[model samples]
Target: MQPEQLMLFEIAPDFRDHKKYRDGIFKTKAQLKEELRQLGRDRIYHVLSFGGGTQSAHLLEQHLQGLIHYDYIIFSDTGAEPQFIHEQVTWWQHRQRACGNTTPFLITHHSSMERGLEEMLMRYIHTDYQRFQMPVYCSTLDPVTGEIKAAGMMPRQCTVDFKIIPVKQAARRAVMELNGLEYRQQMPENIGFIIDIGFSYDEIRRINTSQSPQFKYMRLAYPLAEENLSTADSIRFLEDNGFPTRRSRCYLCPFNCDGARDIGMDWDEIIEAEPLSFLKACWFDTELRRVQRSGSKIMRSIPYLHYSRRPLVEVFAAEYARISAAYRVELAEWVSSWEAAIQEKWNQDELLIRA
Candidate 1:
């Protein structure tokens, strides 16, 4: 294999032979039906956690076509998505209006960090905040020998922190408002919720559980998985209808592959669509390791956003130089603005503590 073709973190040779990876634990359609029966579908609130991406778009289209039902459609913005993803989201909202879909389409973000993942990264870079949420690739360095060995990637907690949990919180608050109760009030036991996720049949292994850990009355269901649909199926459906098919993801997501992978989520796509965001991603990639190496945080393993375990700027050296030259002023302005915003937030918190 060529150098670029090599994956930094490859699965073990015997990975598929392991019981955890080989054994399937997904629920059958009949089991899903029984679970819904127990929750009483007539009384339960149905929510589509619309990701503004291919798979979720398929589910949303079904809702628009009256094939499925949803009381609420929620999109959680991570604040680091490329502008094209946001445009696709707006395009869907316009489609919803065209279809006369009355179901409420709502946008939400993390409760504390309203700006979402970008806020988290900026805070980590500029402050003493230590909770790192991204699933960055990690490596361990031998101090004396100066040799580096690939450590495992960090846990992917950002999805739960900035996306899934925010959607749940927003849905909970919306239901509370509908019931004419305070947001902090406990939800009524009889009013259950079934939140539909968009994981496809091919991604069945991603399914961990049917129950929400935070809310007893809330259960997660995968409609696409239940229908045995693959991601390609959803993409084809969108293409046949002349809909937007760009995959949605954070600008700096480690899952993004090089163009050779042909997996749709590519770094080249980000570079082409939004140069500034690409530069921001490079900045985060470089700064994360710099911070980790500073010996201040609890995490000891060195972190890298790029899957190749190299600096993003180094991976795309020529493109980085070109984009940096082109967007230097704009990038500076963005950094300045975010720095001011974060400082203001910290000052407000300090005042509150004093009070």
Candidate 2:
């Protein structure tokens, strides 16, 4: 019998490590199934999915066959991510179509992320950052002293305004408009939505902290958390099967791997070489924010000179220069190293199935 409650399941193994909890790998699949069965699939009115890797795709497939027909899959593109991810996503779409499933892509302009930051920056500049300021808020504190550090917050409206806000609006729109084929039925006042998040055991902090009143009362399911697999294993399994080696990489993201030792080393070099090409050209330069996050030299805000009238492109010398002026030396190094690490992970050889 089709379970009564609407079931929302996040289809990905734990992202911390490749291993699954409950003592072994691949245990996530079984664990997730049992959890969904008990979670009362009737109330599960909607399924929310974010593609992170091949395993995430697999998770959606599993649910499609057993759980319920998908209402919609909101594919949020940030204009920054591995080139191969686009292809893999296309294949996923095709395969779904072959099986008679309708998946819609929620495309957006590059300004989605950029504009939000610009707005945030404007707000900070207007308020002189006082209203938005926090003590040791953005500064890397001495774990013990918790000193009044130097590094301050830069605009990071990407996650909230750009990604999260747009996603929620799109999902709501999908349910009401009936514009897409995924909405097979009329919209319900309480169109039950269960946002399936692929958070592993280690990412529990992010998962728990992801709560918000805007999305309150709605279902936020965690099938992967129930399964307990780490992110590392998921990537390995996906690669071994001709799926791909890369994760759900975002393009021009400073967080991507860019080191020579990581999995997809070559792509990292290409991206890093043309630093001017970063999506967030503002953050591309020295790694001030990264360093500030860690304990190190702080990124200072002059408050006066830092105020800008010209476009970001012409305002700063480079991504690093802006960061250096904003933050201190240690923070800069951390940011630099971190970007490198992220870029190295997804390489050219990383297979992307785009059928």
Candidate 3:
């Protein structure tokens, strides 16, 4: 049954993670069947927000044949993920199609100019030194004594613009395609859709129903949280089902992996596999530092992607040198034809998909 969107707000109060409470709040199978029995099967369209990452993958697997069947699996590419992630998503799409799944897997994304995080940071925002602030670790001194103190990131706007907005737009088009309606037309209130996210029990802090897009035809659902699942549980499920269990994320993101080893290992692998992308990340770090340098008074150190605040290139200088030596030809290609390469390899087709 299509649960009332407002019911989520009431039953699952802010920060309510109790299993018994959640179980009681959510409808049972029989109850769901009864509630949805009167509606046509196609009345409610389901979407899995496939971020090409671990949690979203878990959600995709979980709702494969559930009562709330997904009509579309949507991926919003920021055009900055490692080549491996793109390949994995392509493989998944083809595999699902080959298996004859009726559900369509669709990829949506920002245009090249607005795609990569680094490009956006370089182009749009500037670091304000006088207003320079750190959310976490800043060395601050007494204001009267001219002391210093310690803060957080660039902007989460990248996610909103690249991922959230694009996904919503794609989902709307997918639903329109299914119904033979114009993409820009308003969705009928009677036609419900659920945007299933991959947030898990371990990352409850990241969960917020209010942050979801508000649409009369759409609502957000967190299956992982409802089922009390964690990343480890998702990994086990994928392994048991014989699906790929790789940690899916943007290669250059410092927040990509969880632990220190995994984080270091991810960077190490990227340094070996995609040197140009690594260099670009370093360029991004350097750009931030440049902004820091502009404000001589507040500039003690440069902000960086890594926790160490060292430029990416410096951290893996040896790896960079090795790759430079091994792939001299490719390194040249990176300088002379890199933009063209991205155009050829990562250029996206029109995102709208119809059944």
Candidate 4:
């Protein structure tokens, strides 16, 4: 049964209240600086975890203008971002060259799933892979009443798995290479790292910790938050400099807002700019529920890409129909190519046991 679609405005007040609570728990810039200083490493490498978005671009521009310094600038591709975001990354790379900034700009992806989120989703749909990473909205069915009610959202682990961790690993490997050490060698105790994220002041709630769980010698920092800059401020700064200001997120990110919400992260923009990716999102939205209902996966609650806990296709029926038809062949080829890749990568036969 399809769950009822709730409007964004109906939920905005609750989100606002939650944000108010979260905003208070974050550590201030002074605290972060003091923590880094306490690490007391002989050398600290500063890295920018560039997201190819407005906030990070603002920081990158600062670096280009000699306002800041970074040992590395890294972008981790989730393999699901729209082409426009990729173009924006390239645009910034060109800008970097034009400014004669010779910082090592690197691109990396999830260590296991090199294709990142799309590969993960495809494996979930096609195989018995159960490590679901997306923060999909979920609903549960009331068996007695035959009604579906909203359950809480799944954990948003993809950001760590596909984005943050990849950047960390790449930065670690890059540093290792620079020091003439093998990838698997233990890091020298004298060296430490501080990777900067692009969370703005208004997005402080998103800042959970400054410590890196995977690497003891590394710490996470937020330059934008330290400067008390909001996302809007970054966008304004980019506009003032005639730079691209598109929000960088996966094409099927659950956080995408509708046009009515007027947030910069809108699905309408995706539909217009990258119709094929939009169709792929709709495909994932429908296939996820179908696979879940098939009883092959452990996730009991029905998952949704749309915020209303409804199918994305239904939410944008007209657009989906039009775009799906327009890109039918391309979509089919995409599906076929992914299926082939999944079979090659994940469907290996088990070794036979000898008696």
Could you tell me which 10 consecutive residues in candidate 1 have the lowest summed lDDT?
A: 9-18
Estimate the lDDT of model 4: 0.86
Among all windows of 10 consecutive residues in model 4, the one with the lowest summed lDDT is 9-18
What C-alpha lDDT do the candidate models reach, one value each? 0.84, 0.45, 0.60, 0.86
C-alpha RMSD for every candidate: 6.0, 14.5, 9.5, 6.6
Total colliding residue pairs, candidate 2: 43
- Please rank every candidate by TM-score, starting with the best: 4, 1, 3, 2
Q: List the candidate numbers ranked by lDDT, top first.
A: 4, 1, 3, 2
Candidate 1 residue pairs that clash: none
> Where does candidate 3 have its weakest 10-residue lDDT segment?
127-136
lDDT (Cα, tens digit) per residue for candidate 1, span 252-353: 999899956668899999999889999999988887887777776788999988888999999999999999999999989998898888888864443211
lDDT of 2 by residue, 196-311 (tens): 65665545444533233465424455565555655665666566656554566444332333244354423234335434333233443222233333332234431211222122
Better of 2 and 4 by TM-score: 4
Candidate 4 residue-wise lDDT, 71-154, digit = tens: 999999999988999999999999999999999999999998999899999888888888899999999999899999999899
* Clashes (N, CA, C under 3 Å) per candidate: 0, 43, 15, 0
